[model samples]
Target chain A: MSAKTWLPLLALAALTGCRQDMHDPPRYRAQGSSDFFSDGRVNRPVVEGTVARGQLRADTKFYQGREGGEFVKTLPVELTKDLVKRGQERYNIYCSPCHGMVGDGEGMVVQRGFRHPPSFHLERMRELPVGHYYDVITNGFGAMSSYASRIPVKDRWAIVAYVRALQLSQNATMQDVPEAERGKLSQEGRQ
Target chain B: MSQIFHPSANTIAKVSIFGAIFFAGGLLVILNEVNRSPYVTRVGVAREQPVPFSHKHHVGGIGIDCRYCHTAVETSSAAGIPPTETCMSCHSQIWADSPMLEPVRASFRTDRSIEWTRVHDLPGFVYFDHSIHLKKGVGCVTCHGRVDQMPLMYQQNTLNMEWCLDCHRAPEKYVRPREEVFRMDYRPQESQQVIGARLVKEYKIRKLTDCSVCHR
Candidate 1:
């Protein structure tokens, strides 16, 4: 063939040769659909009456937030400063959208028109047991939806601890402050 | 023979020989550019999704944290896409009557996937872990490019291997404090080199450039 005829054809072939066969090999990725499965999902739901490794739920107080058909009054895990701090971070992410930073039910979501969750400082809310908060977080209450899928067992307890801290902070008095911390508070107040 | 080559034919032959070199060079340059352009990479191009979910409205306007919906970002290889229930958690009441959210509601009621178009799909050969990157003090804005500013999700960067190497080769150029990893509006107080170098040491971030590190 003449050079005039072949040169443009060569350039066109080179440009169009970028087939993405290697870029997307026939395989399932996370959350991808599959025709091999009847459900059209790559993930198969766990079969009934079978528990996966390390997934036994023997502790009702920890997992169910209840003991002997009643809500437990205390946390199943140890309360520590680190746990509360972790809860603070998780709370600001998960719950604070609808529950407010201080748990006053005035969160941005509520401001944008979601139903108002009651204030944590209310007498009825303050009187509720610690497990009640955990239950609500796990199973949800009223306008709230279950956060079980989003929050794990331990993180739910941590958020419960932080909610208690927020409740206490709202009603704390001068005498509630430690003797050493009292001077610091007064100094900061003066400044 | 009556002169097979005319006198003007010599001039044509010389010009064509010189033109071929320039043509070949220009073709190579154009091919290289086409490989990187948005037409090929889909970078900065927002695709049509089943629902027009706005990251700007949720993240920038409402101030919801990234982890609010993407709960597994810090712990899993895949940053989990929130299930339909996560949308209805607020939308059940927030915009319950809006026609725009009918797809979300239908997905929830029918137990079907929303089938959102994947914006940042990497080739199967390249392995990426969101947890590891966030653990090493890489901010969400580093790869996602200020998601709060995006009205609809788009691939923010070219996501080419060369772009990956740009950071892997010198992580001290982008590493921030671990606490600031989730902050969308995070700006370094001092120079990035100063902050990144200190955090790189503090976080024990290694400059991983091995082929197996990503390819495996």
Candidate 2:
């Protein structure tokens, strides 16, 4: 072939060489081997007393939901309307799938044949301290996994407060509603 | 003196000219085909998996929420694959003897995870978080197309960097209400731009153009 005819083919060959297919870079995969470390593991163990940034977790009552080996009776955070609202939203997204919107433990997951969790309306559940809920969420119970990774610390407290509200809701009597609100209930009754 | 016969150069020139044109046109056609080929984009190609899990039957027919299987989408970076227990929760009682679900049963018994083939894989350089996207009001249908219609899951978008930047540059065009994020069939009641602009302010969304935002 003439030089001119071969020029185009040469260009195509050169272009093909420039492909970006080098995906596996020199990096360690999870639990990969390492030559630099004496232990031969890619991940190094945390140094003694080395706390990750923003993970000091000094407040035992707030982090661990306990004081002197007993669950705290009161919520660690300040209760507010917004906090409960946030809790309601978070609860529907996370807890409601298995615990039901009313905390009756008849969630969609259970309807699909998963183990049924006890209803919050039970006397045993209602009598349990707020910290007990926090502990269960922080470190799972029965077949349920720990939600600590999924729910942040403050959100966990918020969910605990919402669960308490749910317990009160199922057990509430006519006296629980104010006299003014009672009229609204009777108005709906007429309809 | 002898009259020398000259070869016809005209025919050679015409042939070379036509050949070059034909080669260029053929090259263009081939390149275009390669660009849209299934091998490159994988759009509409249903990949084989260990289990033939049908999103159509599960999501559309059975009316299961996306979060039921992808439990960690709201909080974690990854939309986690459901564990064997999630399948056995239903299959154990319903399709207990079905040969198709034997893999699920085996996985549950062995406590081994099913090696599901990833469909919408992004390059290692790009970091995409499901939580931030869902929290920002991007619907499941926005990038995934109509997944409820797919019997077997397949990638619906090119998922190229250019495709990603098209939305990130102007998120208001695609953003929906937080409640509507999981609604697979959700359509904007008003113009998307008007709703998106309001949500942009409400959600405090800023236009992120920095390479480090995703590249890092």
In angstroms, give how far residue B214 of model 2 lies from its true place.
5.2
| Candidate 1 C-alpha lDDT tens digits along A1-191 | 99999999999998878777767989888888888886677767779988777878979999998999899999999999999998898898999998899999999999999898999999999999999999999998999999999999999999999999999999999999999999999999999
Residue A105 local lDDT, model 2: 94
- Report the alpha-carbon TM-score of model 1 versus the true structure: 0.94
lDDT of 2 by residue, A80-102 (tens): 98888878877886788678989
Give all TM-scores, in the order shown. Answer: 0.94, 0.74
Q: lDDT by residue for model 2 over B1-216, one digit each (tens)? A: 865544666787789999999999999999888987888889889999988999998777656778766877888777877767667545656667889888998888875566678788777677789999998888989999888999999999989787899998999999999999998899899998899999999998888979999989
The CAPRI quality class of candidate 1 comes to medium
Scoring only the A-chain of each prediction against the true A-chain gives TM-scores of 0.87, 0.76
